[model samples]
Target chain A: MANVSNETRPLSPHLQVYRLPLNAKLSILHRITGVALAFAAILIVWYFLALATGPEYFETASAVLTSWFGILVFTLSTVALWLHFANGVRHLVWDTGSHLGQKASNRSAMIGLAFMVVMTIITLWIAIGG
Target chain B: MRFLTDRKRVEGLGSAKQGTGHFWEQRLSAIALLFLVPLFVLPFAYNLGDGYEEVRAAYAHPVNAVIAIAFFVTVSLHFFQGVQVVIEDYVHGRLGMILIIAMRLLSTLFALIGAYAVIRISLGA
Candidate 1:
């Protein structure tokens, strides 16, 4: 708002107004996953808090986390965690002035997607004692 | 235009004076997390269903303790910066400012609590 006018300007096409390409979709997904991970930080913090609080508290937290619902949420969070990390690395690569074109972006998107898929599966497998 | 000395002209990032610094903080933290996440999460993930004593033992290890501390401290900064940008983009006016302030306070508290919890657990105190 600094030094900006209150005059309403022509808005860009609404998100629902048009179908977005994979690039835009992935870009938004990066933000979504980042936000997801932000909230997911709470899960880790709670574990530490419970652990420091004592055995009873730790056991309670552990039980809740290992519950079906908790596992489900954690699984989703893990997906988000991996996607955000992979896509973020893509962004960092772009920041270095490499892969500035759509083709390169698409290639990295494919690579990142593959990495996230494989890693998430392996991680969930190990995590769930599978 | 405001008159600037040579040093200020060259050293200043932009009109707002914070152009690249904020960007750099985000990037640097992302780089740190790039390493720290695997170092921290891979082990923690395996301990997901384990009991309290095992969990405590994991963090009690000095390397794990240090990594946890580093992850929390670094992530507080990253989280604050990331969410602050989101708030700025989506929130506006007085409410936006209020949320940003509140978020800053919360992020600081998060780091403090994380450090405290890890240190206490490490010392078994």
Candidate 2:
């Protein structure tokens, strides 16, 4: 039998052992939201295709898209889009050799999150009509 | 007899060398989208509740059609690059290669479809 014991393994910093800082957490979320937005992009393409296909197809898409469940998914994706976009802008700023300090990075991350929330609310308000 | 230094000859032979191009393309597309996304999304959000004809007419505008096409193209390219990085980081071996290829094909197909749809709408067809 092979010796397989947890005590023999060296400990590494992991989610259970260490708490990630806000900036680190947001950075991870940025990648996740980016992936989410990618899937949403596929849905957008399908919607456009439906629109171009004909009135019947467009009506079907519109109906499904405006349903309660559909709107819920759409709103969630929209929020992800804003978060990804805001964090991406923060990344671009860092790429320019500025704002690389921890303080600046943390501050910008907070601002990015706030911006995402405000933008998502505003866009959704405009979209849902009120 | 060679005039080139060893360092110069080996400059682009490593992994970091190849990553520069991918990184720059992502940044360029990101910048393009930073502007074009707002342009596309604003009109799109405004037209959310519009009917078939109204939405079609909105897309028919030259500026709207052009921006929509640009947005589709840039976003697809960016999405492909971003997902490729994700796959490279998390996936390995034959599966990673297959996934990367699939991502490339899917993003390209979606981009083309989106562009064609915009063109069709703009043409009043």
Give one digit per residue, the lDDT tens place, for model 1 in A1-130: 6746656766777877788988888888888888787666777888799999999999888887888877877889889888888999999999999997989999999999998998898788778672
Model 2 achieves a DockQ score of 0.64
Give the worst 10-residue stretch by lDDT in candidate 2 chain A.
Answer: A1-10
User: Individual DockQ of the candidates?
Assistant: 0.53, 0.64
TM-score of chain A of each: 0.84, 0.85
Overall lDDT per candidate, in order of appearance = 0.87, 0.86
- DockQ category of candidate 2: medium
lDDT minimum window of 10 residues, candidate 1 chain B? B7-16
Residue B1, candidate 1: C-alpha displacement in angstroms:
16
lDDT of 1 at B19: 62
* Model 1 docking category: medium
lDDT of 2 by residue, B10-84 (tens): 767667566367888999999998998889876777776579998888888999999989999998999899999
Instruction: List candidate 2 stretches off by more than 4 Å.
Output: A1-14, B5-12, B16-19
Give a tens-digit lDDT track for model 1, residues B42-90: 7888888788888899999999999999999988998889998999999
Give the range where candidate 2 chain B is weakest over 10 consecutive residues by summed lDDT: B11-20
